[model samples]
Target: MSRSAPASQGSVVLQTLAAGKLGVWPLVFTVLAAAAPLTVVGSGATTGWAVTAVTGIPVAYIAVAIALGLFAVGFVAMARRISHAGAFYTYVTRGLGRPFGVATAFMAVLAYNAMQIGLVGGFGYITAGFLDGHGITVPWWLIAGAGVVLVAVFGVSRIDLNGKVLATLLIAETVVALVLAIAQVTHPAGGTLTYTTLQPAGLLGDEAGTALAIAITGFVGIEGTAVFAEETKDPSRTVARATFIALAMICGLYAFCTWAISVATGPDQVVARATAEGPELTFNLAAPYVGAFIVTIGRLLLITSLFAAMLSFHNTAARYFYSLGREGILARWLGTTAPKSKAPRGGSLTQTGLAVIAVGCYAWFGWDPLTQMFFWLTVLGGFGVLLLMALTSTAVVAYFARLRTGDASGVTSSILTGVLAAVALGWISVQTVFDFNRLLGLAPDDPVARILPALYLAAAVAGLLWAGYLAARRPHVYRVIGDGAAAAIAPLTAVPHPAVPR
Candidate 1:
């Protein structure tokens, strides 16, 4: 059996990912780490109220979660059938077509890299602030550079080991958040508990679009569950279960924590307090009840929370590189894994290099790490992911409708769900776009407000062009666009290509 023979002809040996290395809980922890519950409650959730001036942040979280839950139904259904590291990319490719898949591949890589790299800015800002408060001085970029190195080390290590580290940090941060929430809820403002923020009506207010867009950022990492499908012990069950579990945990944690803050500060005053105190508002309110010691711990855990998110997103971005390389959409070298640990070393190192460049540029420009680097980049990344989700939902319906393989009713229900999710997510994506300026805290006239969203269009167009080039000049590679490991086994042929999709 020639190693280069087509998969239809015979067996072949090629670089492959480590399989069966993760379980449901490990996956749950990893995805949860990406959400960074502590950071979300302390920073993202608080910032929503402060920046958007929307008092309905708690319900906005619930609204986004419900929309995502609907998105996941089609998402996991597609995941069960296609187990690959390139979750969205593969789904879109198979469901849509080769060119669209390649386009999605590029977008996924860009979005996840933006997400992972953006965290270093956040970690740097928060850690520097924490250290400064303790009479220790350190440059934010220097600290962020150190964090990038740490994530690089773990990115090339065993996947399960990364999961364990994330689990420890996630558990600690979650406990702190829960304690603070309970403390706040028990000692409500004016000695009365209020449910004004939790009312569904809040989601329909004037600034609700901005609030929902901001809330969606908290759930950015949940879709990552499917990215680890190939490494899970049972991709079908593990990916689905981990996704739902992580979603449920994140939704509940975010809604409860934000609502608790509202209850503690008085619903009418929560936004004002958040605007004045910023991220410190959460701890400031809880300190009186939970004590300065617990408050201090929460602050420290906030730093770790950002670090955990960095690690999780790094691994995800690396795997996207690995998948593209394996499928011949990018440099094949990126597909190579470590011989011993089976880690995606090539892809991991690539992500690390990009991180170093991003961090260095921010440091050199002397920009505000928190606002300029973290906020702008992360929100842009979230917007990109939102676009991918909408596309993937449509792909799901297209893929399942074309297959028609399952029970009639089951298939119909799945298709219907996909259509509904597509409609919901599509509307949300539009809302997010319209609210992008508010989401980034930028003025509507700011040039960045347009440039950042334009990046996605640029990526998608570049991907489509490159896919067209492959179809014209490298037909063999073009034939196996989203085949994953099977791409390696596919026979090399020089067959003439049909017209590539526009």
Candidate 2:
């Protein structure tokens, strides 16, 4: 890939994505590319309980699907014009400023690492289970270790390559689960074709908002559009469409599958049964619905799903590092891409190496991968992304504030995004605290939940300190953080292609 001046920072490699990389609806592809529907099956009622604070299962699904969609309203609006610097961190840099970009980069680094390592554990557990079923015995750590290597190798490849692999795992696992759920719904172990526990009232019995929150987290892949902005064809159009369509598709599937789970167990008895079995009820019901094979499949796919999410976020983290490096905050080596592939080679390698070290530590420490890696990493990383979302929302408001000062077109956007920034950030903070083991009216074991939010606060403090140093010493680079992306983009068209003749 040739280096081009898209805008400001020099020598940022041009992208290598095909125009048709994403079809007419890349978001649709990404939605299916995500195994979100299967999350409900594997995560079961625990997820259902979290998302529907005050509503039923369907209501929880609808509320979150809608809120997530609404969040995308401001999100997609920004995607329209800002096509160059893709990733969530990039948007914050452009819309907000460099200091925030630094902060976002740190947060994203933490989050993506969590997602990657966490999935490895999830994968190991699933892989080990499947192997055990096949009459083979192997430690879960070995399986997870293998996944780490495979994902790292694949991470350096093209974006579409990752997409294709994810899509295949997504389809196979989802089909198996869906077929079983339908079979259960159509023919039950007992009597009635429908279930009362799954009824709208039962699912929505209480705590609908809380349930909605957890359910919505299942749709975490929705934000990938922003992350893949540069890698898609006609990003402005592709991203906007993908966002809405992905939300609809995932929400629809989750609603249907959970409903089926309720119906299969009988609404009145399903909750108690699920409670008795613990949260694994989603898979427990599946033994009859699809057969024992699906439990393995779900586990396998989840580990694979984490792999895909890691690859996706690996690209995201590298880009943020590359962008920041180009702006001179970090070492310039991080910004360099492979001359042949034009991919952020150095940063990508750095991420994989970091993950290796993390996995090694887990192994040495005799840590439970699921408990420490997947759970803690995911929670830590997830909140960061949410924080980035709120920050980006604010950045949009500020970016457009100048436009709305005189231009009517930007006024509505400014107002809308500004309001969203405050509200969304507030909700994220509240939920973080509420979920804390001691803070919430729940179990004492959840005490570790508090660490994630504190980590975020610490990262923010570091970002502020770094910003202050930059402002005092190298104010020029600090000032250009907002348009640092423009630096790369400007050079892309700087030399100019000949104009087309009519």
Candidate 3:
């Protein structure tokens, strides 16, 4: 499809997004909603405790938090200067170049799309299981189809409405988890809530890499804080503050809840029990300590957590489409915002349509949504995100190193943290690649595991080529690549118009 000409020639008036609507709390809840606290507490915690061994699981969460925190130092620094819905993609473009920026944008699209679609599988599987426990019979795909409808509706509505819905669900799930954790701590299974699990020796233990990787996945949506910068009030501070707040919340919650589980189960038995019971491990602890009713409530909340995650991710994916569309990088029609709600309705519809097709395919093939689709695809998404983080880290260094006399905060904020974060994230990205098979629950030499990295590589290469084509043919469109997209398109007059369309 051909892109619309830029705004210079008075082509289509570039549509501006809704603005000054989101605040710190709403942004925090929206980003955290994507993390899905219940899923992290119940499923993710159990997996880390069991698959990676219990001793280091809690410590792993903290380490991942630190790594991400370091990454955020530079991330927020860049956000203050460039206020765009394109978070990592924009950072990479501004720091690296148009080609790398475009490539990372495609990578972000792939990663977030995979993540959103993957969460749908988990929602369907978990919801189906939750209903089955209550003696209600429903197909997983049917439930998933219904979710697509709801998410699409929310995706197109006002952003605050989505925030309220997400906040309610996030609070419900957090309350349940915190209650269970508090009970377990107050009435320790072994007569003490020990700090033994938080020790560094535990992190250096066997299968530590696997534990770290899973913990990183739990923080999957952390980087998305900047994605809503365009819509947030005083985004310069709001986005940065929300990023740290979300990070602290995830780190503290995951560490405490996992430790509480360990203490409640008796650290000695935690790993074995978790390995055997999986998600039910959390419920088992809650059954005796928090009551069976709360256990059921927690289960129900888990369903909502997954649903909240789906909705959060649906909004994120829609905005990525919106960013791409407005920049004339993708189909121009996808850039349109609803006149009343100012929502990226076109992108929202496109994402919803993709979800439907994905759910349909999973059902047609009779694949296990939990294992094949959710677990596998989410890991793949995590891999892509890690790759982008590493690239963005490098971009942070490049962007700052070249700046001689901007806000000194940019240089001070980025230089040290930029270098440290680049090394740390780069290491994790490499580790993720080597351990990809383990992440996918496949044999080390599994063909699918080996092939998955190629998908990301191919997308990046294709994106680079496309950026080149834009430079050679669609120069005006390429000039704004990774530049302040929302700013460029926000003003009706400054909107760029190229004489030729690609």
Candidate 4:
């Protein structure tokens, strides 16, 4: 393992990320925080019921969790073999080709940026509403701008420090959610606990696709478990354990809480309650049993949950930019790390700039922050991640087939898992596309639905064109598209394992 060398005599020097700083628990905290369980249950689930009029959200969460778990089998297998900060990009490059890898990289940037920036809008709207209830007259954008600054600060700090913050916030929010769920379940409507919403059969309806799509959004950050591989103590096992742990937590918590909501309100009235109260439905349901103090705490924790999500996604997006820049696919300067913190400074700054611009534009246009900025962008981001997962699943099978090493039975099982995951994920991606309008609460005829999904295709095409340019003009850089730090020294084919400084 060697350090990254300068690409040219006078080119910007690439710095390595801080390695061996994060362990399994830290990585798990970061992944879970990015998912933002409380916020997902409060706003996302409630919105799903109200907008999509879907009553099977609980079962939908379980189905998605199973699909993602299958996806992780091959995903983790690949991670053990190829360790890189650019998780999806590296996997796609090694398994598919450099052109597709570059395309995946661009899509990751766009998707993660959307997820991070969208959280700002959510934080603003929720924070503003919370303050308004207290007779404060602060604007949502103003609060959002402050959130952007906070995330920027944290994004450029040490990765483990960010993990600590996320862990604390995640723990608090999980407690609030558990307490609420318990209150909801114990006080079931009509003194009867119905298992209707928990059954898989509930997921068969006209709005089923929309419901599943919404559920997928709740797990948007699950794949990010591998994004921190470069910074982990043991990339081989830490990544796998953290990934499954985060997924299981997200699945169980979401399913139980959603089922409790249905039980508390009775299956017949859950949708109507969500429609009327929106995100407040959960708190309102439990306020009678738990009292106003815990409810108030839950409300405050929702704001913190949104902030945690923003910070987590900001780090994920910044690292993607850093990996791209280090590989010479983007500007070399974007690969530099802060000397003291060893954080991706250039990439963090770039992400911050994008967030500022997005928030400023939305505020200037006077768009509805909750619907247009938060819901639409986050849903679009989730769709992009879904696309990446489908492609990466195929890439897993291809990569393993090309290698043809390792235990024969294990390899065959991995290949089988990849095939199944690819098919399931591909179908879900298509379903999400068709139900895009429903996800956004838009009409079937709305052009925005078509336009939003088209952005990924455009990004992929642009990436391909750029890769072609690099292939002709800068063959050296093109040969190392997903090689991480080793890209500066030699081609990926020549490097068995690229090493980062401890």
Against the true structure, whose lDDT is highest? Answer: 4
Q: Is candidate 1 or candidate 4 better by TM-score?
A: 4
Best model per TM-score: 4
Candidate 3 regions exceeding 4 Å error are: 1-21, 47-55, 83-85, 157-165, 185-197, 266-272, 484-502
TM-score per candidate: 0.90, 0.79, 0.87, 0.90
Q: State the lDDT of candidate 1 residue by residue for 1-502, as single tens digits.
A: 3355533233323223233378899889878878899988998778667766778888988988988988888888777766443578778877888889888988888888988887888898889888998999999999999999988887887444466677887888989999999999999999999999999998665666677777888899999888777777667688889998999998999999999999999999998998898778889888888888989999999988888788878888888898888877899899999988889998999999999999999988888777777776777778788889999999989978876865454567668888988998888777777777877777888888778888898999999999999989987888877777767765754342221122
Which TM-score value belongs to model 2?
0.79
Runs in model 4 deviating more than 4 A are: 1-21, 157-164, 230-233, 405-409, 491-502
lDDT of 2 by residue, 1-502 (tens): 7666763235323344352466545456665554345544555333333322222455456555665665676666666655454666556666666667667767766666665566566667656766886899998788777876776666566444445555677777678667756765775547676644334453343343344444544665577776566656666677767787777877777777776767766656664665455335666666664666666666666555555655655665666667767766667788787776678776777777877888788888988665456544554565566666667777666655645545475458555855665475556446555654422224546545556567777877787688778768975555555354555453344332111000
Per-residue accuracy of model 4 over 1-502 as CA lDDT, tens digit each: 5554544233334223333367889889878888999999988888778777778999999999998999998888887777454568788888888889889989989999998888899899989989998999899999999999988888888444366677887888888999999999999999999988888887676666777788888999888777767677667778889999999998999999998999999999998999898788999999999989999999999998888788878888988888887878899899999999999999999999999999999999999888788878888888889899999999889888876765464577778899999998898888888888888888999999899989999999999999999889987888778876667676536533322110
Give one digit per residue, the lDDT tens place, for model 3 in 79-182: 77654536687788877888898899888888888888888887888788788878999999999889888888888884444677778878888889999888
Error of 4 at 49 (Å): 2.0
Instruction: Say what the RMSD of model 2 is.
Output: 7.1
Once fitted onto the true fold, the runs of candidate 1 whose alpha carbons sit more than 4 angstroms away are 1-21, 83-85, 157-164, 405-409, 492-502
Candidate 1, TM-score vs. the true structure? Answer: 0.90
Q: What lDDT score belongs to each candidate, Candidate 1 first?
A: 0.83, 0.60, 0.79, 0.85
Better of 1 and 3 by lDDT: 1
Candidate 3: what lDDT? 0.79
